[model samples]
Target: MKKSLVAALAVFSLVNAEQISIGGTSFERVDALKAYEVGCASNDADACFEAGWIHYQRQNLNKAIELYTRACNANNYKACTNLGALYFSGEGVKVDIKKAKELFSKACELGDGDGCNNTAFLYEQKKDIKTALKLYKKACDLGHQIACGAYKELSK
Candidate 1:
């Protein structure tokens, strides 16, 4: 029993070691940010996207936009979708529906389900029911749960 307790404690410590404590605040796997930063510095688009996601979660919208833009420029579809959302909602930049639409279209072309759904939403707002239904169907087929619900409602 003592041996089992010691082994369990060791495993717990190993797992917890990956987390970071800053000024009495503990954060989950903060070291992942460093790894992402290094990968982004090396021009890895996925890493840039991940770093942007972390900044977004922390409510650092400016930094998130910056990193997401970098990843989007590298043709990261998910990054483009996220950046487009920020622009669409005027989170860190001016609201530019045209730019957001363009980015959403690009991401949809790259097979991103959220992009398809967002593009459908824009079309729905524009009263283009046909295009909205088509895009929503596409998103639904790509396994977007929200899109599936929207598609069902719109189809009905």
Candidate 2:
């Protein structure tokens, strides 16, 4: 009986431990954000994006990054595009221009017109005007009207 009690207590403690090994902690504040988390975890891209943005607004960049990464990994094009933007701007994580381009390209390949436009903008900033023009044209052809204007502006 004593051995069983000890085993049960050990299991309970393990379950209740605060450390988060995989995705980092779920966060105590995550309770209030449960609805969003549920939807995100259930593969709702918009919910994941919104939750990530909300956390970013609250200055919880790590949480935002975590949520954004999950959504992106789930094949959420918008999330991938947004995460690329974050990487480019050094908003949440360190500035990684190369990584940003990779993410933007991934999002674009997934049919995210916005991602194409964003990638073009990043390339423009890098003085790779030709590639930027090409991506902007692609975005415009993909029905991103704003990209047309941006393309014209940057092409000059």
Highest TM-score among the candidates is held by which one? 1
Give the count of colliding residue pairs in each prediction.
0, 0
Q: Which ranges of candidate 2 are over 4 A from the true structure?
A: 1-32, 154-156
Error of 2 at 49 (Å): 2.0
Residue range 49-98, candidate 1, lDDT tens digits: 97788889889998899999999998899999999998899998999999
Worst 10-residue lDDT window for candidate 2 reads 16-25
Q: In model 2, which residue pairs have backbone atoms overlapping below 3 Å? A: none
lDDT string for model 2 (1-156, tens) is 422332233333343323222133243333424445666666766667767876887898998988888888878888898899889899878999898888899898888899999888888888899999999999998999999999888767
Q: Give me candidate 2's TM-score against the actual structure.
A: 0.69
TM-scores for all candidates: the values are 0.79, 0.69
Each model's lDDT: 0.82, 0.75
